[model samples]
Target: MQNQESEQVVRHPFGKFTYLLCSILTLLVGTAFMGSSRVSVMLFCLLFSTVLLTAVVSVCHRHKTLGIGLTLVVLMLILNVSSFLTRSYSLTVLHNSLVIIFLAFVFYHILSAVFHDDRVTLDTIIGTVSLYLLAGLLWSYLYSTILLVDPAAFRYDLVNAASEAVTLRNSDLQPLIYLSFVTMATLGYGDIVPVSGPAQTACYLQAVFGQFYFAILVSRLVAMYISAATHKNQQHAQGS
Candidate 1:
């Protein structure tokens, strides 16, 4: 009856948690690439592959938290493409679109879980959807950082033009990239200043976006984790 018992039981003490952690690490690494580039471009591909593999496992097990895990991987891939393409607004729009997609999938997933019989629990549904939503917003900041680096179209130029009136003279790509991260993080030390109204505006927006996204999304993620833990505990007690 060992096989029978195993087939009848499902355990998620930390399975979902581990998957979410992997996704978060992947996103952080992607963000790190914004200011630095020691990691090869191919390595990015590999990192994303790991993220996707985790997502698939989560999904296959019918984990409540798969949505967010999957969304993060997808967003990372999109951002990677945006960076390599050198196209204006490609990353920005792609980021926004991904966020919207995350929200949509979450809504549908949660609704499905609630309506379907025994396929997914309410706790799992809410936890997965919430985490995915938060990750999307956080990843958007990465997109903004990318924009700061290239300032491909009017959106980026506007930010660079207004900061401190100092025109960028550095031809070295690394310095320019570092400047973008600083602008994105709002760590303006006055070492690099925006030269025009548009540039200043871009800087202001990036700072606002970063702070706002973190304040809201991070709180949501914490709440989801707590919910997941509560659910796991309930299941454990019942099993015992």
Candidate 2:
């Protein structure tokens, strides 16, 4: 019986390993090498799509909806590659939209897995963290789309090392991604400000969602842990 239980645990799909890989890849693409050359950006896009596709397969492989997930992943891959090659605005928008959808799907599955069982394991903890990071990435894509549509959406106080003001396009992804994370964390560093009404609304919404997600996720995990402990103690007492 113990061996069977261990096997079951070992065979669990979409666990800590997958979530950790996704999170690492997301951080690498989103922050570490952003604003690099075109080749680097293309590489990032390709790797990011692969990560998302891996996640979808991991989560949906056992379900009847795997076909749908696979289809989306393929479409996303194609769009991402095409956007990298062409750099067309329409393709970029479509690619961002697909990314958002894929991330949302993965987030939903991770959340479901985290709270599915009474026990809280390492996988659950890692999955929760992944969800948070995924939310930031999702918002970064949204911000990117907004900037692409309206180059004047955001106002950045670009100051050089010499404290000289410089001009930059809002369409540049590095700054928008930085802004997205800052807004998500409610940092309000004031270096990048959302000047347009739509931009302001989106930033404020992201801040509010970030705070609420943190609070709710923490509370849910704590509750699950406590419940699991209580159940285990009850079983111990009953055995005794």
Candidate 3:
């Protein structure tokens, strides 16, 4: 009976955050090294975002939502790819903005699922990791969007270290992608410094948010474990 119960919990759609975590990881790692074509980068993001979004929709148990999400994602993918090929800044900015919306949507669902559950199961721990990845991805999209609007917003390094910036359809959006995660981890490598005020503000905020998330999540897990153990012990004592 205990084994069956554990299996049931594992089988729960909302508890299966491992898939979401893997999908996001693939996106992050793949985009970082997927060669020199921005079209390839956008396509890679398209593939994984579709998969991750579908997973979230399954957890939602709403076929209608999945249908709508699929349609919207696909439509954006086509437009974004075209924008990249045509070198259209407006379309590129629109794509990044839409990506942020989808990331936030998944973040909300996974966070609610992980925190509302009283049990500290393996899936719950995995969901927490998924949330962290989603947070980094969210910030990356925002950074990229800001850079899109104003190239000078970020001080470019791969350039002459001054008065030079990268285009959206070149290689990896590494300047922003790398900086986003490093800032979230609070590493502050200083390789890709944000010269503008908005960029500076985003860096500090993400750093603080990352640290608080780690501290709060660890404490919550520990408290839940203690409570479960104490409740089990009390039941055993009463039986004796």
**Pick by lDDT: 2 or 3, better one:** 2
Q: What's the best-to-worst order under TM-score?
A: 2, 3, 1
Best by TM-score: 2
Per-residue alpha-carbon lDDT of candidate 2 for residues 40-125, written as tens digits (9 for 90 to 100) = 67766666666776677556846666777888888888887787678788998998888788778878887887777567777778
Better of 1 and 3 by TM-score: 3
Q: Which stretches of candidate 3 lie over 4 Å from their true place?
A: 1-15, 158-171
Query: On residues 1-44, what C-alpha lDDT tens digit does candidate 3 reach at each position?
Result: 99999998688755467676677777777776666565676567
Model 1 quality (TM-score): 0.38
How many clashing pairs per prediction, in order? 18, 0, 0
Write down the worst ten-residue block by lDDT for model 3.
165-174
* Cα-based lDDT at residue 39, candidate 1: 52
- The clash tally of candidate 2 reads 0
C-alpha lDDT of residue 31 in model 2: 52
> What's the lDDT for all of these models?
0.50, 0.76, 0.74
**Model 3, residue 103: displacement in angstroms?**
0.7
Q: How accurate is candidate 1 locally (lDDT)?
A: 0.50
TM-score for candidate 2 = 0.84
TM-score of each: 0.38, 0.84, 0.81
Name the top lDDT candidate.
2
